[model samples]
Target chain A: MVKPETLHAVLNAKTVSVVGASSNPDKTGYQVLKNILDAGYQGRIYPINLKAESILDINCYPSLLDVPEDLDLVVIVVPAAAVPEVMQQAADKNARGAVIISGGFREIGNVELENEVMGIANAHDIAVIGPNCQGINYTPNKLCACWPLLTKRGGMAVIAQSGTIGATMGGWAEDEEIGFSALLALGNKSGVGEIELLDYFASDEETKVIALNIEGVKDGRAFIKTAKSALSKKPVVVLKPGRTRKGAEAAQSHTKSIAGSDKVFEAVCKQTGLIRAEGICEFYDYSKILSMLDAPLGRRMLVITSSGGSGILAADTAEDLGIELKQLSTDIKDRLKEILPNQCVVSNPLDLTGDATANRYMQALDVAITSEVIDCILVIFGDPVHKASDVVRDISSRTDKPIVVAFLGGGDVEKEEVLLMHQAGIPAFPTPERAVRAIGALLKKKNY
Target chain B: MHKLIGKALADEYHLNEAEAWELFSDYGIPTPQHQLARSVEEALDAAKRIGYPVVMKIVSRNILHKSDAGGVEVNIMDDEGLSEAYHAIIENVLAYKSDAVIDGILVCEMLKGGLECIIGMTQDASFGPTLMFGLGGIFVEVLEDVSFRVLPLSKEDALSMIYEIKASSLLQGARGQVARDVDAMAELMLKVAIMIEDNPEIKELDINPCFVFEAGGGIMPVDARVML
Candidate 1:
């Protein structure tokens, strides 16, 4: 069982101490402290520095023991040798958690030093995030321990082994206005790692979906077990790199020749119900779609479009991904034909033609949303259509069925309308194929 | 089973061919009927009992790849053929490894025609035991077309792993060929899973060219190699 209190304190700490606080703006120490202040964290902040009287306009303490009260969390950004001393001082101050954002431990042939830090943290009941990492960001509490302040709070949490990947995903979310609940960078993993973080995020009410970037796992069975339990509550999207590394270089048998770590990791994903993303784009795409909408009841899909070419592209991808583009019954087709234009075709991808209007889409959605045969709907906007976002938002609100929209070929209109659709709680894509692929993530095959 | 594995680990690096077959038979995994012979007379008698068109293989503790070591002879028709093949196998084994201890020869019925497949188990650093399935021969060796599942698999998992490979259409009777026995294949996979689950000491195992007969014809493990 995972004790949530330890991580809870770290994410929602009421009192935090930044050891190695710097007066210089060029150092990481200064940047982290500045980010925490910039995020408008309501918690009491303390900067520990022996040489400086104050950092970031906050009074400094010579050591953690010099603080007047107990600390909930400690942000350690000192040199390698000084980390253990700061940790000891934190233990004396009864700090419950610490995020050690320092290097020169375990990663660069310094095994004994990393082990010493782990021993101290374990003995003192301190849940350390890293000995060498890029810090953390929990937006809900306004705690940005990370260097670059990112505070767009949403439903997705990003946990990455590489700090750059974590920041990249966070930046992408901010650019798209997708937002995130938390962004954790795990480096060296000297203490806490993905397993513990997964357990913590699985129960976090703010995190509806999890995006994990893993290089490798230490314990295979434990990872599978934890991932399985976490998946029971929320969807997990994993992006694992180095898929082509030869784990069978010295294999002696036919079976061993083909058995690689990547293959086993793929098996792990299948067994645990974790969505394995093939690349970084798919990782973010899957995470966004899953967090935004409830999974469709079945694979039966209906594509509505204004252009035949974009509709064809969506249909091809849907077929490749095992999503069925079901044909409409004559009765339903006749109903759609009565409301649509003469050039409109009442088929799957129910093309509304080049002269399509918002009313045409509203009418088409009225018929498709009520059809029992259609499980999901994909609306492709190939040309600029007026007030289309309002039509989609109104239609989507009436039913619980998932609706994905693709805004294309309209240039500025596409950009503005896509943002509006997203604001109205609709998943909007820039291309038809991408919208279909996002739908595919929800209906992946179950190995069990 | 414990005693056999214990003796193999105590004396040699892996289980000899005869011991591996015995282990498979004990677990109810179907293999071609065979017997181990210590001498020429025993080889001739074993061939007579198993019938004509038999295959002979040299069982040695030193040689792991029997085919590569020239320790296998197939297509024996009668007594003269068995006699010549048995002597040739011993000569080849001796040539391959001068200090190898010959543990008799395995004489068995030669499996004729079927869709060739391979089932195997290998230890993963993080995942422990992982099972693999793919088409036999060049398919597994060159194309590297295979699907894997962790140990302790369900019936659905077994069936899916078998069909996950790109060449699975062959098992469904591609181009005018008769469909292979997929049910038996899934059952065989389950049995292998159970066997490995029960015996964690097995570091690796390979059943190459496992013949998948036509529907309702069942399956047979033609060659098995077990490493401790």
Candidate 2:
């Protein structure tokens, strides 16, 4: 077992070498080399290419052995057929780490390629990342070795088995304006899998929420044991594909691995307190919420919404997700009734109607935040009087309790409101269902 | 000394089908309705009165594994089959337990259709009584799809045990088969829990092939044995 601190050091290495470095910007080798340089890593950059003299104005060596000094890390962005020789040279040169960023190995569903890659890496005692991968990114170290261009930074760390999924998640995070601590695309997982990555993230100070997109796990018992220990320190969210029989078969073909019975996985999840998401959207939704907001102290939920339709939807989604919509105390209910119209329901949802101003929204939030009956508040605001971002800013200034927001309508208001809410440490979703479901996830994480 | 061993542990060891069934009934476990006969003539008469086709097994004080010794016969559709099966069972008993007293034959009404499942209880030294549920019949050994819960189990605990087994989907209507009576299965588990709660001397009990029918038909304990 690799130590978490050692893995962190490897991820945050200052100096790195680009093996098979190319001057062609269109190729993956060139793009990754460019990303590493663009991230402004203050370290020596050694470009190792047999044919090239220089790449992007950085001097290129014929091989790692030809380099003048020791390298902290080596990134392999070459063809699959040439990987073994490059890895051998890297090992002989005593490179501290190697990231294999190429395809056509095990993930291509060929046993011959898998065995050959494994034999070479094992013989050299090299801890390789992937033969079919987009590589990895570490925000704190300003290290970016992955190809598909990511720039945002935050507290959520993503560890995905699929390279495409990891890159897509990074892209999604950037598009949603959510920052990431790290993005690791572990393709084929010839050397490292979720078990090692999870143990690595367990002690990583920068990672507040660890999200996993798993296809098939190697060791069920070991994974469960490691996950159980890690989950106590930080929340671990999993979006597992290959749940159905056909999907499991497809996953086996995809990674050359077997997906065990979903029932066993469910039992393990229950025992080890791993939060499982249904799909990609829920995965991002839950991860974003968990990254931004604190875990709910309890399951008691209070909904303060201006739109009656949105309020009803939130309440229904809450019940479906097993979140208890507790009744407010008489004092709290009376206070709400006195401020609201006669038609407004002064119950669990505490509908304030569409006529609510920013002050009214803050007052309702204040009541829910102070009440002994409510554990968390889900505030859904209708079309705002001014900009939706202003309402979000006011709400954040008013409440200390974990607040999740759902903006009702579409426009610049929705986008600006979500961004503002996130900036103020409140997670905002596009729909009431997502907001309620996120609250459910937070409650589960706290209890587990 | 052997007699002393039997006498000292008489209340703590072994029950034939009828005795086990009565004990289970006392604890609210359901079993099929039937009677016992002391002879082949009486067995035939009991089958005639109880209606055919029926199941018959040799009842002897010293013989416990009647099926293994060829003392059990099923689906005796007529008097000829019944008479032949009875004499064969008697001959089997005479050969296996020559010194033991013959305690008649048990004639039971045949239980039909539905999935076969087994519910068992064994008292572990550390865990106390651990209840188990699994697919019954010949393939049971090969397919060890079983789940266990430490007793005494609540209804929720019993349901969780059933859900724990991978083959539980088969019981819950997999591939167009009607879902077995899960409510009845839960009730059966509750009954087993109560039985173990009441009889601390029972060290082990096996109710193999607890025939579970479709919804509304209920479940029946076709065969059972107990060891104290």
Candidate 3:
């Protein structure tokens, strides 16, 4: 375990300095300085550039020694060969932490570079984030230490080994309107890796869910321990990229990482209660659902659909995916039978048949959701003829049970209904399979 | 049961073919019909009664690995070979076990070739009574491909064990070879596991070359050894 004082100084530092800050806006150093100011961080920002006296209307210092007071953190955005000297200067200035947002270190297939970078960080007694990274972002603290374009909020702590993937996830989070507590691009992971970030997030009161996009894991045992501890507090969703042999080799070459056997990793995930997402989209999609909705108590799914064919397809998919099509009790079935014609299928899937209105959809949901046998309910709107927004509002106001809405068509129903449902705290997916998979993941997490 | 033999009841014992068959009958493992012979006359008589193309071996309590010690003689066709083999067996058995008591000889019908396999049981420290199944014969150790399940396994458990081994694909008709009777093998392994679990005093048991014939033909235990 890292010391609490050290962890605090690294995560909650007040003052920050940008070493190797450039006057050129095209350089990464200038972008780092601009992002910090744009995020409205309350900390003092000092840009250190030897050639220029001032950059971005802030007076620039020639070196770390020229800084007058104790600096809390230093952001290094210089070339890989010049990092050792800059780190030596940060050590002299006693900076608490440093974020190395430059590439061409150990990730460039050089062992000597990795050793030198680690040596510098160790001698300085400073915790480093990355050598080839896109820095960190803490929304609540107004700390935008990354170069990615994103709007920060407080819900999840996103950790990724690849900077590009982390930036992409940030973009997705912004577009999806899901807030994030912290986003860390753990490039190269020479000093600090997922285990440290996981430990930090395990006790963080602001973080609700941890979304990780990993190409490979360094230590399996430590990961299992940290993940087990974190999952006990909050849900930990992982999207491991190198599942196949070819993918594992590619990941090894890309990050100098070791990818373990996929079967063993799957078994570990099952044993440790870490939810494994299928793809990149599902990774974010499931995280959104888990964060926004309540966990279903059981696998008994009650799907209410307007189209009979869609209802049957949903039923078949549920059965194939090990989800039980819950049989509505006698009272609920009798009520549905009285409300509908004799030709309607009044069993588990409760098909409303064609030519259904908003009131009929609400009636089916009310009847299915009140039953004691059903654990979750899926409402599929097939080519909505009535006002879709009105039906969504009525369904959202009615029940507190976990509901996933699937919009079949492509027009306003998909765009408007999904937004209304999302805003109402109910997650909506485009297809029933995705919704079912997300609900299944939530149920598994709940039992775990 | 012909009073069996004195060595068959000893604390440390080895049985010849006829005595081993009697012991196998006692344990409910089937063995081929055979007879024992003492001299050249008895050898010829046993051969004629058991039919032609019989296998002969020198039988002694002290000599367990008969083939390694040159005590086994196979496919004796007629009286001339039987006469020469009788003297050869005596010489070999006497040379192999000079100080021990010797049984005369074993003459039995030759078994046809089939898919060979091994089934055995050993007490694991963590989980007791581990049953093992693998491809048998000389290649058993070389291949080192095997599967184990806890003792007293059900038929389903036995079938799962067979499918668990890495080389199980070979038994499932790999390389255009005929598939063996795996169901029969599973049943036999389950029975053996149950027997071992029931009789805890028996420390180790090996049924090597449990020849499993092609489809529709059942498996049979050709040779077995047990230790307490």
Candidate 4:
């Protein structure tokens, strides 16, 4: 029953308005208006401010009613108490959606004011994003309604409960050049909640994978149903903080005495086909790996390493994660032996020693990718190797199988190899354990 | 089934063992054949009818843990042993709790030893009814070796929940022991799922030490504590 405004109008509004538009470049109002212009939004902009004749060289209106035409979206950056009036005005002017970037409201326990704004938005059929939010974006549409800092468009969509965390994740994606299709922040959640947004992004062509940072859910059953439907077409990675005792202390289960637990959430994810990330870092790690490749058919992983220790560590982590490490048969071993040195161990963690070169890594990768048994490949490199970047190139072009790499140890050589893989659209981690985790996210046998 | 549970909870916070067994039986769960006896004479007669050697335990609404308070007596070989044990149970329970109200003694045929497993239901405020399955016995929770899934469970979910526990190997016959009946256990789980699905007011259900016999022997719910 709580359907949001057509996401098309909210994300790709042709006629936008910025109420309480600021002339000061340092203010949030100014940043929001500037970001829209900077993101190249090819739409009409109206600055609703009585004090300014123009903002960012765009003509300004005294109020929403003063505008000559209906608006598709409105970004409100006024004080909290002033939001309901602006919302009422936007509704009167037939604005389809309002992205309120103001603070106060339910976030500070001001439920009365939040309710008044929600009532106004609902009555006028105005879909509000926030009263206190970090704002939102749709990079493909060049609609950056969020902060001025922006990244290009990609297939991953980040929906986080904490605006700060969402911004940090967006920044990391920008830094790593991992583009995002959409970045939606949930402010006090007095407006549209996560479930409504999930339904919108589930079918969004630009969003191939959806990542969520949730503190808690208001409606468990509805959330599960929404997530379950979304999961059929794309991967939904969730990160819910506060499960430990310390985490529990911050939250009180207002329901029953048995208490709410992360275990039940974990079990729900297990049943609903959603992926649960243990930490913030793992959320992006999963997104990076998932964005790079499709889901593997089976959990059978093949580890190809130049160092024995890294290989063993990967095997152990893979086993702990319940991923089956396919033991290379003698026939496959013989094929590898033809290219690797005599001292190389032709086993499951098919290690080609410390002195092994990129040729050996590629030979093993080539054989594994060609094997009918292997479902995915995990390549590890430590110490010196010949053209580590070449291994990434061969894997990226030669095979359709999902590939993840671990460039172990440090130094410019190792760092360069990791960056090279990222540039080639391959997910590479710094440690063997991390690489194994990345593979586990995509290659696990039983998923929701 | 709800009426039975309601009547049991009419004046008490919990159900007596016999009433709980009735609810389990209504859901297709098997229980040992037994009858309640109000006196030593009735206890001896019920024992004879049920076919001794039998188990005679105090059936009191106040006595939550029967065995702990020396309220249970087993292996009644004859009328004399039955009479002696019946009086001893009453005396011991009254001594344990001076104000305790003794209902009667439940006389039943002794069950053979089998694979001990446990099944339970706890209503999480957020998730509603959740079912738990693991190695059965009183200390099941202390071991903390259990897996849970929100109900109503499908046949597939029920089967997986059974083996998802670490103690599942014991159910399949560990250390030369006879392999217990797994299908019977899965069936029991589904039936329990149905029972809870019909009633949401049920706060917790404790059916510990469910005995799963050798293949084809079926299963039995030995003890239960149904709370509202």
On TM-score, the candidate that comes out on top is 1
Which of the two candidates, 1 or 2, achieves a greater DockQ against the reference? 1
| Deviation from native of the Cα of residue B137 in model 1, angstroms | 2.4
* Residue lDDT tens for model 4, A1-448: 3454466678878989998889998788889889989889888899888889999999999999999999999999999889888888898888888888898776667889989999988887788787678888888888888884785777789997778778877777776667788888877666677898888888888887889887777777787789878887788888887778767555433111123567777778777878888887888888777777776788888888888989889989988998888777778778888877789888888888888778777777877777877777888888756479878787769887778888876477776777677778888887888888877877632333
Error of 4 at A45 (Å): 2.8
Q: Give DockQ for candidates 1 onward, in order.
A: 0.48, 0.06, 0.04, 0.46
TM-score of every candidate relative to the true structure: 0.94, 0.72, 0.66, 0.90
What is each candidate's fraction of native interface contacts (fnat)? 0.66, 0.00, 0.00, 0.49
lDDT of 1 by residue, A1-448 (tens): 2258888888899999899889999998999999999998999999999989998789998988889999998999999888888888889988888899998887777778888888888898898887788999999999999867787888889998778889888887776777899999888766678899898899999998999987777778788888988888899999877676442343212111223388888988877888988888888888888878888889999999998999999999999999999999888998998888789988897999989988889999998898888888999998988788999999999987889998899888888888788777788888888899999886652221
lDDT of 1 by residue, B62-173 (tens): 8888998899999999999888988888888888888988889999899988889999999998789999999999889999999999977989889999889999989988
Per-candidate iRMS values, in order, are 4.0, 10.3, 10.8, 2.9
lDDT of 2 at B11: 50
Displacement of residue B81 (Cα, Å) in model 3 is: 18
lDDT (C-alpha) at residue A217 in model 4: 71
Write model 3 residue lDDT over B1-228, tens digit each, in one string: 223434454546644556656756665666665777877898899888988788787677777677876777888888898788888877877777777566778887767767888887776532356677888854459866776665547787689778867777777888998888898888788667766666665567788768887876878886666655
By lDDT, the best candidate is 1
For model 1 the local lDDT of residue A45 reads 96
Which residue pairs collide in model 1, if any?
A303-A349
Worst 10 residues of 3 chain A by lDDT: A1-10
TM-score of 2: 0.72
